[model samples]
Target chain A: MPDKTAPDAARRSQRSRQAICEAALSLVGETGYDKLTIEGIAARAGVGKQTIYRWWPSKGAVLLDAFTETMEAGEGTLPDTGDLATDLKAVLRATVDEFNDPAFQAPYRALYVAMVNDSEVSAGFTSKVMEPGTQAYVDRIRAAQDAGEVSEDIDPRLAAELILGPFAQRWLLRSQPLTHEFADSLVDMALTGLRPRNPRA
Target chain B: MPDKTAPDAARRSQRSRQAICEAALSLVGETGYDKLTIEGIAARAGVGKQTIYRWWPSKGAVLLDAFTETMEAGEGTLPDTGDLATDLKAVLRATVDEFNDPAFQAPYRALYVAMVNDSEVSAGFTSKVMEPGTQAYVDRIRAAQDAGEVSEDIDPRLAAELILGPFAQRWLLRSQPLTHEFADSLVDMALTGLRPRNPRA
Candidate 1:
């Protein structure tokens, strides 16, 4: 779909760009990220490699674009109803669902492979992709802290980590099955917690 | 060092094997894992690639062996004084130190790359290496649950994830500076509490 805000010429450009991203995603799903090439995406999309290079510098960048688009379509804005625990659980449950989806998982695995292999790609993914994605949690945690919902002694940054870190570990590391049960349990443990003595105090 | 428990002939073999493992670590550090080859390790260790191939099926396996050996030397055992909070903190803090160390980080990055690329390597690493390493935590979490230290409602597996997931996230994702303080905070948060209402009840 073209960006509706654009004029006809700009709409055509947007459509072409969207096609290129779709091609990137398709090929990555088919070939895995390591075998995926810019040439292949361009060929699939009926565009030149120069067309892709004109917008994105590397295959990793193109994949990152595709990931962000899919991500927006799936887990866009997190809820903020002033109930921090409920809100966090909802967002994390969505994440569990996303990681379970093959459309997201395969390409994501490829991105991780690319990130660890190339420092430049890693930096781009972190700055352009991850840092922005994390802001929602950071904002929510800060809000909770300010509202006295979360303890003032808690570091919002670390609090955010407590929520998302385990998600990343389970999903990215493939350490265990990503389940809604697991996600809810994380929120449950985080809120009520494991301490016999209320370790927070 | 040779495995002291081995007989004289086996002791000599162990010493030779240790040299090869050391060579694998040194080369992985110097050349990075991608460029590391069995032939290169053999040449450095003054053995044939057949020697490496004899004991381990792949370079990744050899690397895992080296990782396990190094890990045993560094941490020996997680302090298991039956105090879950203290024991978890100590283990996680050591992990922070391990990830921060160049020796572990380089090979671990290599292992992660290898795991993504090869199913066989992934299986071996996950089952043989990760599973065993994580069993300690799983056992401990179960023990805590049985002792009524942790809430009975909590899934020990999920609880284990909650404890180590953040540590893995900070270390593996390269999201933030992994520190002892961060490790302590995770344990503190897990034990003391996060929610005012105690979601578990």
Candidate 2:
């Protein structure tokens, strides 16, 4: 038989984690990352500072978790429909929508700012948030290659970088608006190069 | 004969501008952009806060000027060699060197952080710092198209974005070391798509 105390303990732990994440996001959004403090987050979440420290090493880590959670809630997973074009377009369009959200903007901005200011944060942020998406793209490209849809000589990792790099550049720099049309065009460009072969000669 | 006081006044103004720029860079390097203030810069430069306010709208403006000045001092202009490959490699190599400089890194990183945090700052930062380099690349690509070196169908602006996007992505995220070799490879990959343009069809 299942233990009643086990369920109660699990629920309490889950509630604590949720409260901590919410407090971290709200603090960073209201006050920039540089100004946010662990004590402030603890007070805001009605938990002790030691509780936050027990779960997370730093405020940057907490914020990273919050940001990752928000992205996952929206479009963190790459959809694989067995069609590379359809899947990539679907993912990129979802990314554009996420980037447009106001709730995501401030904390997203703060996370990148934190990365710029701290090298440790940059490494952690890259490994946590960026690597998963990159790996997923690579997997999709490799599958396409195996199916003889993409060129065999192309490096899947680099190819994925090429597809995602332009969007990241524009989004991070605010060089242009990230729209569904822009995502479509990016997919078009990426797939054109990834097509079975090219005849530009 | 011109009044001697006019030349003296011009020299004094130039001196003040130089001092202010230096102070802004130093302060931002010591304390990240978020903590930097107009008052701090003014005090460091031995000028009144109102003097800085009179010339620039905000601390971001001062940092922008400092960054532009640093770029100018290092590589005054983007190369215009007729060959796209040679010219792009030269320009990107110079950029890699600039990014790797200790003096350039902090202020540039600070400005980058500020741009990501504020939309207005992003717009201004792009217009002032990024647009000029992008325009130069566009001109070079246009020249390549006109010379029959590249396909005319390629959008010069988009092509420029493609070439710089990878470097910018890596730099902003601090994902990899920005080296001359990496920059060269990026240029090559962008110019010639991952798939061979003349593969046997």
- In model 1 chain B, which range of ten residues has the least summed lDDT? B71-80
- In candidate 1, what are the lDDT values of residues B1-201, reduced to their tens digit? 877565887877898799998998888888865578889999999988898888988787788787667755333235568788888988888788878988778888877777775567777777766767677787888788787788766777767777777787666567678998888888988776665544344
Residue-level lDDT for B179 in candidate 2: 93
The residue-level lDDT of candidate 2 at B150 comes to 67
Per-residue alpha-carbon lDDT of candidate 2 for residues A1-201, written as tens digits (9 for 90 to 100): 877998898898789889999998988889876578899999999999998998888787788887777665433346667778888888889889988886787788788887887777888889888888788888888887787667777778777877888888888887878899888777666555312232354
> lDDT for each of the candidates?
0.77, 0.79
| Interface RMSD, one decimal, each candidate | 2.3, 3.5
Positional deviation of A122 in candidate 1, in angstroms? 2.2
The numbered model that scores best in lDDT is: 2
Docking class of 1: acceptable
| lDDT by residue (tens digit), candidate 2, B121-188 | 77878987888878888877887778776665667777777777877788877777889988877776
- DockQ for every model comes to 0.44, 0.40
Error of 2 at A64 (Å): 1.3
Q: Could you say which candidate leads in DockQ?
A: 1
